[model samples]
Each structure stands twice: as C-alpha cells, then as structure tokens.
Target: MAPEQGTGSRSGCGGKGRGRGKHLPGACWDTLWGDHSPPHFPSGQVVKLELLEQVQAQLRDVLDKAMEEAAQSYLQPHRKDPPTQHPSPPHSSGLLEVEHFRTFYHIFIAMLCVFILSTVAVDVINQGSLDLDFDLFIFAFGCLPTVLATWLVMFLYTLLVPYKALQLWAGSYHTVRFPRLFTAILLEALLACHAAVLGYYPIYTVIQHQLPAASRFIVILKQVSFLMKSHSFLLEAVPGIIHAKPPDGEMKLPALSTYLYFLFSPATDQLPSPRTPYVRWKYVAQNFAKFLGCLFYSYFILECLCIPVFTNMSKQPFSIKTLVLSIFNATLPGTFLLLLSFFAFLQCWLNAFAEMLRFADRTFYKDWWNSTSFATYYRTWNVVVHDWLCYYVYQDLFWLFRGRSRVAAMLSVFIMSAIVHEYVITLCFGFFYPVNCSPSLPSSEVSAGIQVCLYCQEWYAQIHCPLEQKTFWGLVTPRSWSCRS
Candidate 1:
C-alpha cells in the first residue's frame, strides 16, 4: 500500500492493525467515501477528506475578507470625501420666506419710527425741544468690557486645557493596560477643573456682584455655550485619536487652526474638516446686514412691547382679570421675542459666519413655523444645538444601554436639556424662578402632553377662524398665550 493509504487505514482502524478487529465504524467510513467511491474503497475516503479540508479553508478566507470589508466601510463612511451638503429650501433672496416675516419687519420699522416720533413729540409737548438720548441702549449693554474679558478667559481655557489633556490621554492609551479606565478618570478630573473655573466662578460672579441683566446674560450664555462646545470637541476628537492607526505608528493631534475653526463655526459638533465652498463677499455682506437688522428688530420689540406692558403689569395689584390681561399682553411680545431669537441666532447670525467661512451647509433652521407637531418643532427649531445633544448625549446613552432602553435614553436627554436650560436661566437672572415647568417635571409624558395641548389649541383656532382672521392673528397674535397656564 502507498504511504497515504497506509496512514488512512491506521487512522480508520484506531491506530492499530485490522487483525485486532478494532476498526472504525462503517458509518464514519461511509461518510468519508460514500458520495463518489465504491463501498469497499479506502483510498477514496482519503481523497474526499482532503477535498473537504480545502473547501473549509476557502470558506474561512472568504468570511474573514467579508468581515474586514464590513468593518472598513463602517469605520470610514466618509472616507476622505467631502461632506454632503443639504441646501436650504428654495429662496428668491436666500432667506426663508416664512409667512408674516416681511409684514412683521415693516411693522417693526414703523413702530421704531413711531417710537422716535413719539419721544420727540412728548419732548416738544413738555420740554419744548427734541432731546434725543441713547441712555437706554447704553444701559442695556452695560459692563461690556467686563463681559468680554470674562468671555476671553473662558475661551482661552477651553481652547487650550481640555484639548491638551485629551491629547495626553489619547497618546498614552495604546501602550497602557486598563487604558479605558485610566483615560476616563483623567477626563473626569479635567472636567472637574473646568467646572470649577469656567462654570461655577462665572455664575458666582454674576450673583455676587449683582451684574446687570444684559451683562449677566452675556456671561451666563457664553459660559453655557463654551462648556457645551468644549464638551463636544473632546467627545468628538478624542475618540478619533484613540482609535487611529497612523502609518508612522504615532498619533497626531488635530491642528490648532482646525480646532479654532470648530470653536467659531456655527456648528456645535466638531468635524475633521467642514466643506468650504468659494466665498461670495456679497452673500457674506448680505447675511451680516440681516443679522444687524434682526438685532435692531429685537431691540424695538423689547422697547415697544415687553417693557411697557410687563412694567405696568408688575406695578398693579394681582387679580384674575389683571393676570389674564397681563398674559394676553405678554403673549405678543413673548412670541415676537421667540421668533426674533430664532431668526437672529439660528438663521442670520449662523448664516453670516457660515458664508464668511465658505461653509456650505446652510440648512440651519428648517421651516419650523410650519411644523404641526412639537417633536418636529424641537428638531427643526435650532438644529445646531439639537444635533450636538442627539449625537453626544442621546446616542451615547442609547449605546451604553446596548439599545435596549430607547425610552430611558430619550427621557435622560430631555432631563439633561431641561436642567441645563434651567441652570442657565437661574444663573443669569440670579433667582430660583423655574419659568419652564416642563424641565422641572420628571415625566416626559407630562411634557409631551403639554406640547400636545398647545398644538391642539392652535389647530382648533386655525380651523375655526376664517382665512382673513387667521392671517391677522398669524401676524399679530402670540403663541405664548397657550402656555400661560
């Protein structure tokens, strides 16, 4: 017999001679040879067994190659390609043509003109001469230097410290055992330090020094915004550094210029590099003009509506009638303020920066005014911040739970957002006024119910009112009335 046949016989006969009558079972021999061989053929069995091994090896190679391809695709979806840009809805003038926006602009300009005429008329009636002063505007922006200095300090710390710490931790991660735990502890400590300096100190200064409302607003808003930005930067960048395998076998930190751009970019999340189309100076100039226009619009709204009505209501005794009237009055200005804020920051301000930087993604605010649902409103209102919260907070929490508890993850996001909102308001106002009730409540169901009731009221009113009446109301009426209760 040949060597291979002899080896197969020994294997089938339990490593002994067949004279011992200790041969392998007939079923095992049949399985190895039955498909192509005669019933008594041992040589065929060896050939079939070798063929099966070869086929198994080929399958293993194919599976490994498939897995590797899948992983590569997932990890590098963009793969050095330019980011896809979602253009804003069609606009003849590049601004969203929402209903009543132009009408409101005209009305505000007229109101501002009326304000100047009225002030001059009153001066002529009393002092007999026009004495125009901008003391109110100056007062509204008091302590400007202090606010800027505070912001500059916060900006520097955020720019330098957290990023450096992240780099340090990421550099050490690969060589060290228990790197995840060590890096986590390092991150927590850095956050603790940042919180003490930027978070607590600024708030304490606002309260302790009794800063003016405008000054306090600048400080507190900057504090909160910078904190969020820094957190997002670390959350986004550090992971890339940690997992990256460079050809040189050394991790490289992201460029300072890229990070600085991210800090100033209208976007809340960090990108490796955002797309920059060729800049049009005209577009940039137009957006800046609109930003200034919105600022003036907001100022007039506050001067004409909020101050006069809210001030008078404060001095009067509290009664049901007065309370009801105050709410009705507050609604107009409140809604105006809301709209102004939305347009000014999310649209005009962000777009100006985006255009100047040649950043192509300009779909910042969607047509949120047309949203029939509160869920849609939240998503469409201010996408920059919403994107950050969804990615860094909500998605991370969902991932931590292994995607088993979606409701829990969503609730956690709402709770976190509410807390931040309340914290910013309380710190800015230096008071314990929980103006937002939804945030205070633990149940997301309650929050959703509130939104639903508000939506229903608006829907009902629109259904009942005639087209002309609806148009009038849409221009003048405030949605804040629905939330008064």
Candidate 2:
C-alpha cells in the first residue's frame, strides 16, 4: 500500500517501481505526492508535503519488518499430524543463501554491468543521442484506459461477490428451513454467476478491445489469480460452516484482512515460514538488483543476438541446412530467455514481494535444470504452483474417490492446470493451439477426451469467431506471439 514499492497484482496501477511485475508492465505511474500525510492527525489541518515522503518511507519500513506471512502449509507430504475437521487452506525464499551460489550471482552481476557499459558506448557513438526509447514499453503496455477499466471490473467482482455470498450463506444456513436444499441452490447460483463474469467477461474484453501484449497478460493473469484466490477462500470456509454449527453470535467469518492479504500474496495458497523475522534491506536490494540483471540480460541478448540471427535468416534463401542452423542459432536465445524469465519473474521479483510482505518460504525454484526425467522436471520447475495444485486438486480428487484412483486424481490436476493455462493463452494470443498443453497421461482416454474437446474448440475459433478478424486455417496460419509465452 506504500508508494515506494508496487503492491501485488491486486492493484496494478499506481506502481512507482517502474520495472516491477512480470504481468503488470508498469502501465501507470503513481502520483508525485500521496493522498495522506503520515505525520498528520485526523484533524482538519493541511500539513506540508515535504516531510510526508520521508515519514511514509520510515513507516513502510517499520511495517515491512513487523508484518508476518500467513501460517498455513498447503503441501507437506510426509507430515504425520492428523487433518483438522475444519476445511482451511493447508499449505504452502530468497534468491540465494548458499555461499557458492551467491558468488556465482556476484560474478554474473559484474559481467552484466560490463554489457550495460558496452550498450551505453554503442548507443553514444551510433545514435549521437542518449535518449531512451520508452516507446516500445509504451506500445507493449498500450491501451492504458482499457487495462485499468478491465482490472477495476474484475477486482470489484472478486472482492464483493464471493466473500459476501459466503458470509451471507454462513449466517443464514442455520436459520433456513431446508438447509441442505438451500445450500445447494445458493452454491449452484454462485458458481453459475462466477462462470459467467470471471470466465467470459475477460474473454469478451480482450477480444473486443484487442488489448496490447502486456495489457492482455495483466488482464488474463489477474483474472486467473483472482479465481484461484476466491476459490481457496471459499473452499476453506464452506466446510467449516457446514460441519461446525455454533450459536448465532459465536459464528466466525474469515477476517477481511486475511482474505485481502491472501489475494495479494504471490502464491495461490497462504505462505508460512516462521524462522525469518524482519526482511533486511539488503535482501530486498538483492531481489531488485537481480531483477535488473535479468532485464539487462534479456535486452542485450535480444538486441545483440536473437534479432540479428532472425533477420539474417529471413533475408537468406530457405533450405534444410539453413533451417537447422537457424534453429541452432535460436537455441541460445531461447534457452537464455527461458532461464532468465524463470529468474527474473519467479525468483527475483516474486521473492522481492515475498520479502516485503514478510513471506519466508523462499523455495521459488529447485534443481530443475538437473532433473533426469520429465516427471521430475515438471514437479520441480515451479515448486510453488505445483505444490498448490497438488494440495488443492490432486489431494481432494484422490480423497474424493477414497484414494483408489490415483490416476484419476493426477489426470484431473493435469486437465485443470491445462484448462486455466490454455484459456489464458487462448485469449491473449487470439488463437488456439494446445496440442502440447494437454499431455498424455497413459490412461489415454482422459487425455484423448481433452484433446478432442480442444480440437473442436480450435476449429470453432478458426471458423465461427476469428479473434484477429482474419484467418487462413488450411492455407496459412495466423501468427501469435507473446512475451509471456
């Protein structure tokens, strides 16, 4: 909420930290002076704005130290503790604490600085002007009015609809004449409304407006995240309300602050780590510093290497050898971008927020690069999201069938993750090609069914509704590229 650092994806606008979020592309800037002065009391006196900034910075620092993350673990496979009757969220650091890894990072930072100097020298000599080209950033994050409007619409729906509905249900379920029937009807109606507004509204907005690259991502990802958070909140609250009926005045609702915090937290489920206390300024510094390195690394690699190779390939005659060489040339940039993206968004930036938010579990990534098998790689690649999926989807489905159908549970998890990813990709890119998103699960029928459904959807998109307004299905394919992809 402070003016210095950007809040989470909840409020995308008013970020003073320009290069902050991966999804939020810093489309809007915060005001020079905040609306409130920290030193002023509620009295009507209008205070000077000079000391306001310094006081806010100090207050923010103190709060960052005092704030602690939620105490819940969504995934602890080996834990022996018995499950509680109440259905609360039962889950789930830093960049580098290891000595050698920190040293490697330090060396990497030195090399990045050298590249930055080289770029400066090149710009000075070649352009004869040092003015930066923020236009590309502007273009990527273009359509600001639409982006903010779309965000406001989604945030308001998520904030009000689910929370209030659940609160109302909690209070009235005991008083209703036919509680079970009433509960079922209320739940069905709520779900139908969620499907309409959260699901279709963003799709309509994106298709109608044809939002720019970053704007589309912000809208799409924010919608997806809000859905997850709302689901988690309700999932945790519903069972407790059902099984444990107390006196009217003794009834408890999830605190509004906790729900809001969970919505803004980096991960889907609540994050809990008790060992670390206040986050040091250096740790926060390390996060942003590494983030800047990623930006510089990406910029230099694209401008110096990837762009040239692609341009040269385009001009040259097409051939098998050229294709092979082009692919070979692309391998470096492709690999670099993938790795840098993992470090930049997940490790650096997300952890920066975790630190500031007093979240202690810093296991953003694992030794995924060293993974020997596909299963291992998939599990380790993004531990936070995978853990969340395992806890919520896999565990629930596994128990839903009394643990007899592990395959069914795993397939459900895969299908659910694919659906969300595919939906985001579908609208953002304005095309549908999810051949690889739905992978084979050996049961064959599940994957086959999903693939068939996707095939039908793709054809529907290509025929009835052309998102790009023009399409060549059989002859030529519409090209869809995204920075997020």
Candidate 3:
C-alpha cells in the first residue's frame, strides 16, 4: 500500500521534509501533476463527470455484492443447513478418517482405558476391593421422565408453529393483498411468540421439576438447538419459496418428511441436496461405544480428581487460600472434563446420531484441536452449533449490512452463543449466574476485532477448510474455557 518512491519523494509538502528543512506545496503539486499551476476546466469536465463516474462505479460494485449476498442468503432454492465456511458444498469426512492422523483415534481409546484402570486402582487401594459407585452419576441423570416430557412439549411446539406459519405465509405471500406489510406483521408476531415461549419454557420446566444436571442439560440443549433450527428453516425456506418462478401458478411447500427429518437430524443446517442413505450399523455402534466411553472416562476423571481433594477439604476449614488452592487443583480436571464433553457430544454423539439416521452428514466438527487462531477455533469447534451461528446469525446479519462491518456480525454470533450458554447454566443449576457470559462476551468482541481480517470471503474455494499448520498455538486449548472455569 505504500506509494511509489518517486511519488513519496515529490509529495512531502510540509513545513519540514526528511532531510530538507522545508518544502513548498507548489513544488510537490507541479511534480505530481506535471504543471506549476494546472489549467482550470469547466465544472463538468473532471470534477463533475469523472467523479460522478467513479462514484457510480463504486456504488455499482457495492450493489452487485449486496445482490449476490442476498441471492445466497434468501434465494437459494435449497441449502437449508450446509456446513460452516463453505460457499459451495463442503468436502466433509469423519474425524478419524484423516490420512496421517489415525493415531489420534487410538490415543483417545487408550486414554479412556487409562482413566478406567486408574479409577479401579484408586478404589482397590482405598476399599481393598475394586468397587465403582455411581450415586453422583445417578443423581446427575435423574428425572429422565420429566426431561423427556419437557423435551417432547418443546419439540412439538417448534415442529409445528414455525414450519406451519412459514408454510402458510409463503404459499400466500405473493398473492397477498399487502405482501410486505402482512409479512412484517406476521414475522414480528411469530418471533415474539417464539421468544416468549422458547425463552421461558425451559427455565419454567427445570424449576418446576427440579431436574438433575444431565437431565437439565438435555432440556436446555434441546431448547437452544430447536430454536436455532427453527430459525434456520424459516430463514432459508421463506426467501427461496417466495422468490421461486415456477411455470405453474401454485407454489410448492417443503415436504413434511423432510422437515421432520431436519428436526431429528444431527446437523442443524440444511443442505442443498440430501445425502444418500448409508446403513453403517458398525459405525453407529462404535461411535455409541465411544460416547459411552467418554462418559465413563469423565466420571472416573472427576472421581480421581475430586475424591482425594474433597476428603482433604473435609478435614480443614474453608478460607480464601483454601478456595484459591482448590480452584488451582480443579484446573487440570476441569480441562479434562471440558475436552471429554467435546468428545462426547460433538464427536461421538452427533456422529452416532447422524449415522443412525442412515442419511446424514458426518461433519459435525473439524480439527478444532489444531486451530491456531481464535477465529479458526470459532469456525472449527463444534461445527454443528457453529454452522447454525455462521449461517443463520452471522452471515444473515453480515449480508444484511451488505458485507460491511463483519465485526458486528461476528460479535452477534458470540453474544447469541453466550446467551444460550448462560441460559443453560442458569436453568440447570437453578441459579442465574452470568459467569459463563461475563468474560466471554468481552473476549469474543476483542477476539473478533483482532481476527476480522484473518477470515477471507473466498475461504470455501479450498477443498478442505484447512488451517495454517501452527507449530505452537495449535496445541493450546481455547483460553475462553479457562476463563469460564
């Protein structure tokens, strides 16, 4: 971006130059324009005509970019929930299917075994017999009946309300008497209703039933998931259906089966075309096993870290120093629990569910562990939620502003994510603590500011959405996790 050396040398029109004590503006002007005093022309010559033309060209470029984004966001005939950072269809593969990194899969399994054995060893040394107690686990997963009923109620509302409203509105949108006005009113009404219901329903149910930790997680997680999925469906479907130019007069509605599938499918985003059915029974079984292994691994990890510490704590009085030391001690186990959560939910559970569906995409997550920058981590980590945020929230808002101020869009994404995270914790723990949201909101904005330029618009041109092989930072887990801890 530096100017030419000749231009720079000629253009130092100031009281002081680099070596020369002073330079006159006339000298620099003449050097740049090749005239001591340029001859004036009519107002319409350069000032009016050329400036107008340049302004028009710039406006046209902005307009064209805006239209392109609108078409992608609103006019795509398909593409309900495509993966993140992919313009066209993305190249997706299983986590363990990478060429040179199969060892990671084995390493996870070995870690699982190690944790299990260590848990057994500790029990034997203490009780003189290998015995595993799951009172805490049972407590965590208690109240399953109420959890299931609550999920069903929320699911039914999401399944029917948004889809039906969108379907009816789209069918009559073109033929309506006042299309834009009516559509605006309808949208606001639906959104308000949705907000009122989904906003308070999960918290109400959790408080009413006093559900346990894991049980409450299911409810809160589903609430967030369904809210996102419903928004995505409406965002994607409404524009495409309304904009369709069919030879026949009547408009087509999305199939109920497809909509139902989207509700149950592992991927939150919609795709342009459906994936072919693959009955990978063995793969499903293996992933379920891994999911269970992650749970047991987490349990043992908690026990290994907590049992001795709690025993010691019971023998001593609580104090500021003790609390600080306890936090420091929990750091490593907290890290293990977080990683195990990722493995359990994103890698194992999503993959298993997708495979069980017989026709679902398996790119639930990516090599997020290898991400060097927070921006890449945001895109690669937990791609299911990230895809919904990127597509329905970030891209929607980004394009709404005509691709200007991506920082706003990125911040909106993190804010939405933080709200859901805080909401889940508040409802699950029966306390409204913004601990998760407090640091993350500011950190995400700061990260967004620093990382605004790291992402490119044409990132989808690559085959696999790969990151630069970072030697050091790639190995570091996200600092945001530690802040929450």
- The 0-to-1 C-alpha lDDT of every candidate, in the order given, reads 0.64, 0.65, 0.65
Query: Any idea what lDDT model 3 has?
Result: 0.65
| Candidate 3 per-residue C-alpha lDDT over 388-464 given as tens digits, one digit per residue, 9 for 90 to 100 | 77777788799998998889888888887877776676566543334454333222333322221111111111112
Off by over 4 Å in 3: 1-93, 98-108, 121-130, 244-248, 310-324, 432-485
lDDT score at residue 432, model 1, on the 0-100 scale: 35
Task: Give the TM-score of each candidate.
Answer: 0.66, 0.67, 0.66
Candidate 1 accuracy as lDDT: 0.64
Query: Over the stretch 1-485, how does candidate 1's per-residue lDDT look in tens digits?
Result: 22125554445435332221113345444545555544343665656655654664577578879998999898975646433653442221244455577786777667667766776787899999876565656776777877788888888988888878877887777767898798879978997989887878787777777677668888988787788888888877776776777555667677778778877877777744346545556766877787777666666666665556554444443356755565555555556556666767777777778767767666676667676665676687777778888988999999999999999998898778778876776565443334454432222333433332233233333333324444544534523332232
lDDT by residue for model 2 (1-485), tens: 44435553224344353222222222222332244333423332223322443565577677666553221333435546544332211122434656877887787678667767777788899999674674546666789899889889888888889988998899889888999998899899888988888888888888788887568988998888788788777887887788765774466788887777677667777545543345556767988987877876877766665655554444443456754565556555555566677888888888777767766665666777676655676687788789888877788899999989999888888788778776776666556576556334412333333343333334333443334444465323422211111
Clashing pairs in 2: 72-91, 73-90, 73-91, 73-92, 74-90, 74-91, 74-92, 93-361, 93-362, 93-363
Comparing 1 with 3 on TM-score, the higher-scoring candidate is 1
Clashing residue pairs in candidate 1 are none
